[model samples]
Target: MAEVAISDAQERSAESPALAGLAAAEAPRAPAFIVTIYGDVVEPRGGMLWMGTLIDCCARHGLNESLVRTAVSRLVGAGRLEGVRIGRRSYYRLSEAARSEFREAARLLFAPPPVPEDWLLCLSEGLRDIDLPLPWARLAANIALAPNRDDLMPVDGILMRAKQLDGHGDLAVLAADRWSLPEVAGAYGDFLASHGGLRDLLARNVTLSPEVALALRLRLVHDYRHAALSDPRLPRAAYPQDWPAEEARNLFVCAYVGLSKAAEAHVGAEFLSPEGHLAPHNGETERRLFQLRREAAG
Candidate 1:
C-alpha cells in the first residue's frame, strides 16, 4: 500500500493563517474548473462521476451549483462529456473524443514526451492546401520545417530528416521566428509568479485540509495546463538560455505531489462515481503519485 507520511511540521503549518489562504487565491471559470476536475480526478478513478460530487467540488472554488450544471450542460453539447440518468441521480463521463484529447493533455502534464532530436523538412507542391500540425512553419512555397515528433507524420510531403550544419543564424532566432516564444515564455512566467509560493510552502512541510488540498491541486493543474499545452516542446538547443518552462514544470511536480495525499483523501471520502465513493488509492492514482514523486526526485 502506498502511504503518505505527514510530518509534525506539516501539522503545525496547517494551523498557520497565511498558509491556509493558499488555495483561496482566485477561482477560474466554471467550464475550465469542471474540466480540470474531470481530467485530474474523475478520469483517473473512472471516466464517470456523480453530478453531486462535481457540484460539491466546484463549490470549493466558489462555483455555484447552478453554474456547474450549466457548464456541464454546455460541455455535453460541445461533445466533451456524456450524461446518463440513474434514478434521480445523474452521472457524466468524458465523451470518447474528449477522452482521447484529455489523454494527450495528460501526457504533457504527467509524462512529457521527449523533444525530437531530428528536424523534419517537408517539401510539397501543395503546401498551401495541406494542413500541417505539430507547429510546422512554412519556410517557402514548397517547404516547411518542424521538429520531427514521433506522434506526427505529414503524408502530404516528401519528408526528410534534417540536421543544422554550421549555420550563421542562431537556433534561438530561428525558433522565435517559427514559434511564439514570447507568448509561451510569458505564460510560464505568469504560472511561476502565481504558484511559485506554493512550492516554498510545501517545502516547509505544510499539510492542508482535504478540501483546500484538492481545490489548490485543481487550480494548480488548470493553470499549468494552459501553459503546457501552448508550449511546442522544442528541443533545448532551440530555446533561449533563460527559458522558465523547465523550472515551472519542476515546481508543478513538487507542489502537486505535496498535495496529492490530502487531495486523494478528499476524493475517497467525498467525491462519488457511478459506483459510490471513489477509492482513495486506486492503481491509477497510486501510479500518478509514484511517477510524480520520481519526477520530483529527479
Candidate 2:
C-alpha cells in the first residue's frame, strides 16, 4: 500500500527543512520518502522496520542517509513512528495513533475497488472544495462527484447519491463532467511518454544499477499515482474519443514489473537481520504487482 502519514488529509508525513535542498534536486521530501518507506515497504512488515533497513531502502530510492536519519528522528518526535532498541539495533514502527489511518490508507492503496453500488453528487458553492469519505480529488473550485453513498444531510453541503437525483445520463458523463478532462488527460499523456520510454529501455535489456532501478520504479509509480488515483473511474464514453488512461496504466504495469525483480533483490540484500538473514518477501507486494500485471494484460 502507498501512503503518507496524514494529519490534515489524514495523509502525508513530516515537514522539515533538513531535506529542502536535496528534495528540490532529487525526489520528494525526506518525510515523503519516509511515507513511501512505510507504505511501499515497512507497513507490510507489521508496521516495523529496522533502522538500517530504512536507511538502506531509502538510499536505493536516492534519499541521502543523513536526510533519512533526520526525517526518522523528526517522525519519532512527531509521534508518527515509534522507535524501539532491540539488542544493538533499532527498529521503527507506526505509532499507535497512526496505525489505523495507515491501515485505511492501505485498503485504498492496495485493495481492488468494490463494485460500484452508488455515486455521490456533492454540490458545494461556498465551500468550493468538499472532503468526502472516498479517495482522490479533494481540490477543485467546483462541484464534485464520487462513487460512494453517504446518507445524511450533512451540514456543509448536499451529499446526493444516485437515488436522490431525479435526472439520469450515462454515469460516465457524470464522471467526465465533474472533472477537467483536458488537464487529467494531459497528465496521463506526459506520464505515458516517459513511462513508455522506461518500458522500451527495460525491453532492450539495458543494464541498470540497483539505485537507478529503484529511482525509476519510484518515479514511474509516483507520477502515475498522481494522475491515475485522481481519476473518477470514468467510463470510456466520458473521455475524448481516445482516452489515455488505459495506455498509461499499461505502461506503469510494464515498467513496474520490469523494475521489481532487481529492486526486490536490492531490498532483500539491504534489509538483513543482525543474524545476516535476508528479509523475506511478505507476498503482499508480489500479490498486488501480479494482479496489476494481469490487469495490464487483460
Candidate 3:
C-alpha cells in the first residue's frame, strides 16, 4: 500500500489565511486534494484512479465530497487529469507528458538561480548582440522529439500562400513545419523556469491588462522559438557565438523580470519572494497550469 504523510506544517499552511483566500470559497480542501492527487500518481505504476476511486481517496484524506468533485472537474478541465469513459464510469489518470511537464514546472517554481544579479544581467545583455553560428540541423532532432500538428501546418501553408499573393514573403513550408507547438511550449516553460525570478519582478511592477500580458508572453515565446529554429546549430544547440550570447541571455532575464511583474500585479505579491522567488506561486501556478492542461486535453 502507498501512503502520503501530510505533515503538521502542511496542515497549518493549508489553513493559513493566504492559502485560504486563494482557494475558492466553500472549497477549503480543494487545494489539499489537488496536491494529494498529484503526489499520489507522480511516480510510475502508481495505478489509475476512477471518479469513484478518487472520491474514496478524498474521503481517506478528509476532503469534502463537493470539494473533491470540484477539484477533479477542474483538474480534468486543465489537462493534468485525464479521463477514460467506459459505459458509465469515467476513469482518471495523469498523462505521462503531463507528469513530465508538471515536474519541470515545479522545478522552475522552486529552483533559484545562483548567479549574482549583476552578472546575470551582464551575461544576458552580451548574448543578445553576438549571434552564434547555430547548427540548424539540430532542429530536426527537436522536431522528432516534439508533438506533431498536421492541422496547424495546413493553416500555416494557407497563411503563407496568402502572404505570397499579397507580395509578402514567408519561410518555406518545410521550415514552417519544423517546429511543434508542444516543443515551443516546452521551451518557453524551460525559459520561464530558468529566469523565473526576473519574471516575478516584471509581473510585480508592470501595469498591463490581462490581454496584454498574454500577448507579451506569447510574443516572447514565439521569438524564442524562431530564434532557436533559425540558428544553424541543432535544436538543442546552446547559444552560438554569432550573436551576443550575453545579450540574448539578458533578453531572457529581462523577459522574466517583466513576467514576474505581470504575475505580481495580476495574481498577488504573496506568490513571489523579495528576490522574485516563486515559492508562494508554486502551488497556485501548479494548480493553474494543471487546470490549463486539463482543458487542453479535452
Candidate 4:
C-alpha cells in the first residue's frame, strides 16, 4: 500500500542526509498539522476523509495514532471537525462552523488577497472584542487601522479614509510598532533555511518518490502556513525594506509545484473520503496549481 511505501521511504531517506535532516528538524503539533492536511489535500478534493486515511497521512509527520486521535477529539471539541460513522468505520469532515476559517486559511496559503493602497482609520469608544475584517490592527484603545477595501461589507464604526502625505515618515517603523514583524521575519528565515536544501535538490533534476514528495509538500505547507498566517499582510509600502515575504512566497511556489505531481499521486492513491479516493485533479486543485505555476514562471 502507499502508506507502507511512505514508511519505507522514510527509512531510505536516511541515505540522503538533506532529506533526513529536514524530516527530523520539524514535527509540527498534531492538531495543527491535521488541520493543514485537511486544508491543503482533503478540502479541495472533497471536504471529508476516512479516519484510517488521516492516520496514515499523519504518520508521515511522526504523529502516532494515539496523538492523532487525541488531536481529532480536540478538533471536534473546538467545532473545527465533526465525525460520521459508516458501519464500523469513522469518517470526518470540516464542521460548518470551521469552513469559513478553513477558507480564509486557504486563501492566505494559496491566493492571498492583495493589500489595498488606501487606508481606513476606525474610531470607536466601545471597541472590545469585535471581528472587523482581518488585516486590521489596533493603534490605540479607541483607534484601529486597516487597508481600505471595498469588497468587505462595512462594519459598525466611524470609518475615515486616509492617505499618506507626500512627505511621510518611515512606514516600516510604524508597521513594526503595530505588528510583530521581527518574529514573522524570523519564522520566514527559518523556513527558508530549513527547506532550501530540498529546493536546491529538486532544482538539480533529482526525482522524488510519490510518498517522499507528499511528505515534503505537507511539511512545506505546514511550516509556511505559520509564517503567512501570522503576517498582517499590510501594503508593500509599509513593509520593511528587508521583508522576506516575497522571497518566502517564491520558494513556496517553486517547492509546491515541484513536489505536486508525485505528491498528488500519493494523495490519489491514499487520501479517501467516504465516497471514494480523491481525484488527482479537480476545479479547486487545478486552480491552485495553475496560480502557483504562473507565479513560479513569473
Query: Any idea what lDDT model 4 has?
Result: 0.82
Candidate 4 weakest lDDT stretch, 10 residues: 10-19
Candidates in order: C-alpha RMSD to true structure = 4.5, 11.2, 18.3, 3.9
Error of 2 at 297 (Å): 2.9
Off by over 4 Å in 3: 1-32, 105-119, 122-298
Candidate 4 regions exceeding 4 Å error are 1-15, 128-134, 150-155
**Model 1 Cα lDDT, one tens digit per residue, 49-96:** 999989988877778899999999999999999999999999999999
Return the number of clashes found in candidate 1: 0
Give the candidate order by descending lDDT.
1, 4, 2, 3
Candidate with best lDDT = 1
Candidate 1 TM-score versus the reference:
0.90
Residue 269, model 2: lDDT of 63
Q: How close is candidate 3 to the true structure, as a TM-score?
A: 0.28
Reference-based TM-score, model 4: 0.89
- Cα lDDT of model 4 by residue, 1-298, tens digit: 9998997676566437545855577678998999888888888887899999989888877888999999999999998999999988999988876777878778777777777786888898755567555567778777888867654445567999988875678878888877768988999998898778776777776667787788888889989998897777777787888899988998898999888998999998888888889887789998999988987776
Error of 3 at 245 (Å): 33
Q: How many residue pairs clash in each candidate?
A: 0, 2, 62, 0
The lowest-lDDT stretch of 10 consecutive residues in candidate 3 is 153-162
